[model samples]
Target: MDTDTIDGQPRVVATDAALAFIDEIRKDYPDILFHQSGGCCDGSSPMCYPADDYIVGDRDVKLGEIGGVPVYISASQFEVWRHTQLIIDVVPGRGGMFSLDNGRERRFLTRSRMFDGGEACAIPLVKRG
Candidate 1:
């Protein structure tokens, strides 16, 4: 999937800095995925993991992809974030304890913006089980 925009409007996006960081991470773990934390120990940060290390379950909703890696959120969290565009970026800090980003010093952060009427209507509907 495209990094940010789908068709035209974006459901999830990443800054250039974040994309660069993702590329760096990819050098080590070619196959990776992201799951937006639901305010557990990570405080809602975007967590990265090797695809083999994490299981994408039915409760996870695929919002979009970034740097060719898929990003997902829990169905319950999706309900709360459905109206906004998720912006994935990097910040100087520690990552989630169990996330791949943990030892990197820099962590993935999730910022967002509410979709306007047109964007909201244009965004694709995600089917969750």
Candidate 2:
């Protein structure tokens, strides 16, 4: 369900269940985005919001798009996560308090895996594009 990648390795991706959840969310909210929380009340979950509602800061890093929505992480968080791909998945739980997925009986989870040498090298330079 991932929408973009770099040389066959995805910078961010979503599971089929996550994609389905996104589709469900799109029914009521069309323009949305995902921001990976760097630990807080949500515990590092991917928080979805109405694009116009959240202010994406200048220092935020857009890893890629998943489910037709842009996925971002703070620059500081990206420093630690840059070497890995973000795998967005849906699980049974409450979502972040302010996230769009809240009250939906499911939440967006951020899972990751470290990239191989080549992928790690290819990722950092193009985070903004």
Candidate 3:
């Protein structure tokens, strides 16, 4: 899918792996959703949610359909990290199992690591059973 930016924040590319992961999770929990409060260059980490809980930061980033699933970013984060690209991959971890790549060359384990201002912590979502 072509990269799209909303209100400046870079949108994450939903790859086959990402879609598959979403599908797997959805099968167990139909209300699963993905949310990000940060972005690349100076943003937070990306985390999954059972429903949209986190408030939108700045721009409204739209991640193209992944396995027919939709992903979104809060409007607030979009304003600061616009045009940023996120790379998603599965990694072995305790609570936070997803990894984020801020279009930049650097990759981070948690969203807090990308943004220097916010409290650095791992945002973990419950694995769907």
TM-score of each: 0.87, 0.89, 0.49
Candidate 3, residues 1-129, lDDT tens digits: the string is 223533333345555555666666667657655566454533354566555444434444565444554456664554444334556554344323342222223332322113222211222222222
What is the RMSD, in Å, between candidate 2 and the native fold over all Cα?
3.7
C-alpha RMSD of candidate 3 = 12.7
lDDT of each: 0.84, 0.85, 0.45
**Model 1 weakest 10-residue run by lDDT:** 1-10
Best by lDDT: 2
Cand. 2 TM to true fold: 0.89
Compare candidates 1 and 2 on TM-score and give the better one: 2
* Candidate 3 or 1, higher TM-score: 1
Segments in model 1 whose C-alpha atoms lie over 4 Å from true places? 1-7, 122-129
Assess the local accuracy of residue 3 in candidate 1 as a C-alpha lDDT between 0 and 100.
26
Worst 10 residues of 2 by lDDT: 120-129
lDDT (Cα, tens digit) per residue for candidate 2, span 28-107: 99999999998768889999999999999988878888889999888888877777888999999999999999999999
